[model samples]
Target chain A: MSIQIIKQGMADSIQDNGRYGYQHLGINPNGVMDPIAATAANLLVGNDLNDAVLEMHFPASVILFKQQSLIAICGADLLAMINDVFVPVNTPIIIEKNCVLHFKKPLSGARTYLAVKGGFDLQPWLGSYSTNTKAVAGGFEGRNLKKHDEIRFRAAVQKYDAVLNGKDCEILQWKASVKNFYAAGNILRITTGSEYDWLNEDAKKLLLSSSFTISNQSDRMGYRMKGDNLAIENKQQLISTAVTKGTLQLLPDGQFIILMADHQTTGGYPKIAHVISADIPTLAQLNAGEKIQFNIIGQQEAEGILFDQQQQLQQLQNACSFPLLKFKQQYAIN
Target chain B: MKSPLPYHILPLGDHALTIELGNSIDASVNQNCIAVFHQLKQAGLAFVKDIIPAYASVTVVYDVTAIRKEKPSAYLFMKEKLEILLAGMDLDQPVSHRKIEIPVCYDLSLGIDLQEMSQEKNMSIEEIIQMHTNKSYRVFMIGFLPGFAYMGSVDEKIITARRIQPRTNVAAGSVGIAGEQTGIYPLDSPGGWNIIGQTPLKLFDAKRENPVLLEAGDMVSFTAIDINEFHIIKGSI
Candidate 1:
């Protein structure tokens, strides 16, 4: 009936697409870091894209399932296992009652997502299930998942009669291809920002030519970068303005930070660039000390990539629902 | 009717676009930004998710999937729509401005930095309170925290810089001034502003029908209140 967290993770919380339309009131949209992965995980489990999912970081929480259920993990490959047996990512898996789910070690990527079949049974705050830890609203007591916290699933998954074997977990046949979304290399595509002209010619050149290391001070708020000191022509007291996720703001001390999912609604720093919306999933998977380079692409190209990604997600959602409907009709006709 | 101000549309990202009217925080520039905000919201564009108005800019967040169905590019479609909306529009038209009177208690107990600001500005606490309550301010932006409305143009004589070291936790309803701008702390947060007063009224109530008390482009004026009145009003809410 419920999944109890036996071991605590660094920062595991329930998240969905995001809480939107509240940025004007200074309320940020705190959602999943990797939308591609989160959406893929939800689609694999035949849940709505906006259904609540557990976003877990490395050293993720250990959970004990008290009922048979369907789930899928995506994003970072944290070496997930069920009862000490390895389970693949981006594939729907059926877990038997009283099974334990845990992660082995930090393999690749910074965060991962786990989606349940019918989603979590909880009241949403301000029209979203995404947890806003700063505002202390929405999702599992408005905080990170810790030890001994029990989260109830909306409905128990009907026992899969096709695979009625003595096994702790049953991995399905079909899997989703999420590799194209996370492109090769650390080169992130970006477009010029409002204050891109503030940087001198050499500083502008340095931005594209050099690779910056993601500093250890980075967090969900933003990723501070360390690289060549890019100097501006002058320091002007700019008026504070609306900023969004993926904004690359230049600090006064010459470093820059890529604002992430939990960034402030407004900022005063000069915005030098913004990572393309399509590539935010790739950027979200990067960990501290990882070196990343920026490449400025045209705005049209950025929009094209984002549009294509949405289309691909829709196609995946359509493809996954067919088999899920057939399986439900055959076994659970209630 | 006066023509609209010259502005440039810049892409914040693939999903959003920012309209920069000017560089400074002039009233006209801010008004123009607010005008665009109202017009876009009234248009009822299904693709548009949200619109934010700052000092001299307005950002429109849109869904690329929906935009792609209608037009090839979201930026190009939105920019053209905005350009057309601004062209036929008259900037001289009066915008909807709600003048709200806020009750603030300037007692030294709640006004943590009143004594320090009084000495630094070479004025008495009473004079400081009078100067703060005398003039009205415009809500240029609501940011930094939920319901945190950034009001501007504090009395020149009482203009003070932020604290050298910011306090880790400034209580909610604390009114503070930093440079030429003054704002209320809707939530207890780390801030460097010089606190001069506290309002018993909740700046933000998530359970309330309207979560935020103030919005961008509203007119705000403060009235001095005694501690007894502050407690009375605080208890009623």
Candidate 2:
């Protein structure tokens, strides 16, 4: 009925699209850093795009399914394994009861999302299942997944005798195409921030030309970038204002921070540039110390990329529905 | 109904747009921002996910997928709609406000920076406390942390700049001042404001009907209380 965590990873928590409509109350929208992978994972499992999924990082969690279930692992290629056998990501897998799941090594991205058949049975706080660690009030008891934590599935366990064939696990043939979304090759697209003109000519030139390394201090809240000092032409105070994810704020010391899923609702720093929303998934996948370059694009182009991504996701969902429904009905799975 | 102050809408990212009313924290400018926020919220546009009001701007976080379903370009669609809405809004007109009175204990133990502030301002501790409690502060924004309220224009006599080095952790309910602004930390977080008092009432409670205690455009007045009253109020809440 539930999946027990044999071992816990760093900051493993449940996340969805995000907690929204509460920024006015100073509540930050804490959600999955990489929406593409999270959505694809949910789509693969025949779950709603907003269904809660387990977000795990390197040294990922080791889990043992207490019951047979259909699940899909997406995003970071952490070398997923079940019962000592290798498994592929971006595809659904039916696992037998008591089969152990773990990651062997970090292969590609920084975060991996695992989605179950009918989503988690846990209750949502404030209209969302995403974990708000600061408030400690949402997602799986409002905290990171601990060792031995058993999260129940929303759907009842169904016997996958036909698919498993007495085997430990079986992988499906279909997989979501996720490569093109991260095809920017470490270059994240950006749009002009409101305070973009605040930067001096040299700083503005350096922003688009030079590369910045994601500092070790980077996390879900914000990614601190280390690069050439970017200074504003006029050294004056900026009033606190609303900031969203991908907001590249120039700190007082020339270095800047790119706010992420857990960013503060409002900030006072100067926003030099904003990473286009379409590239947030790609930016979220970059590991600490990875060098990332920025390319500024028009607002329309950025929105076009975002619209295309959403359309692709919708197409994937549409393609998987019939097959998933047939398979679920065959096995009496919810 | 029209906005007297000049305002412009800029795309924050592909998914969000910000309406900049002014550069500084003028009350009229913020009022205009709030006016726009209220109108948008009232419209209940399905594409708009959240509307956040800050000191002098309002940020509208929209759903690109939702917007694209109705229009070819999200930015253009949103910009035109927002422009039309703003054109008909009378930002000069005053909006109703909620006044909230908060009790604060100015004891030194709870206020770690009181002694330092007293020395820096060359004023008696009582005078500093008097200045803080004397005037009603306007909450220009709610941010930095959940339920944290940024209120402003403290008495010039007690106005202090942020500390050279911010403390690693400031306890919840600790009231602090930074330059012309004063705020209370609703959660335990690192901050740079100069602490002067503590409040027992929980600024934020997940179980409460309204989790956030204060919001932008709120009028907050602090009433000084003894240490015992602080405990009694704390225990009661």
**Highest DockQ: which candidate?**
2
What RMSD value applies to candidate 1? 1.9
In TM-score terms, candidate 2 sits at 0.97
Interface RMSD of 1: 1.0
Off by over 4 Å in 2: A329-334, B1-5, B92-94
Q: Which predicted model would earn the best lDDT?
A: 2
i-RMS, each model, one decimal: 1.0, 0.8
lDDT of 1 by residue, B116-159 (tens): 99888789999999999998999998998889999988989988
Clash pairs, model 2 backbone: none
Docking class of 2: high
Cα lDDT, model 2, residue B77: 92
lDDT of 2 by residue, A157-211 (tens): 6778888999999998788878987846699889988889999999999998999
Provide the clash count, candidate 2. Answer: 0
List per-model TM-scores for chain B: 0.97, 0.96
Q: Give the share of true interchain contacts found in each model.
A: 0.77, 0.90
**Candidate 1 lDDT score relative to the true structure:** 0.89
Per residue, candidate 2 scores C-alpha lDDT tens digits across B1-237 of 542558878888888888888888887777777777888889787688889999888898988878888898998898898888777776666589899999999999998899999998799999999999999999888888899998988998888989999999999999999988999999888889999999999999887878999988889999999999999999998
Best candidate, TM-score: 2
Q: Which TM-score value belongs to model 1?
A: 0.96
Least accurate stretch of 10 residues (summed lDDT) in model 1 chain B?
Answer: B86-95
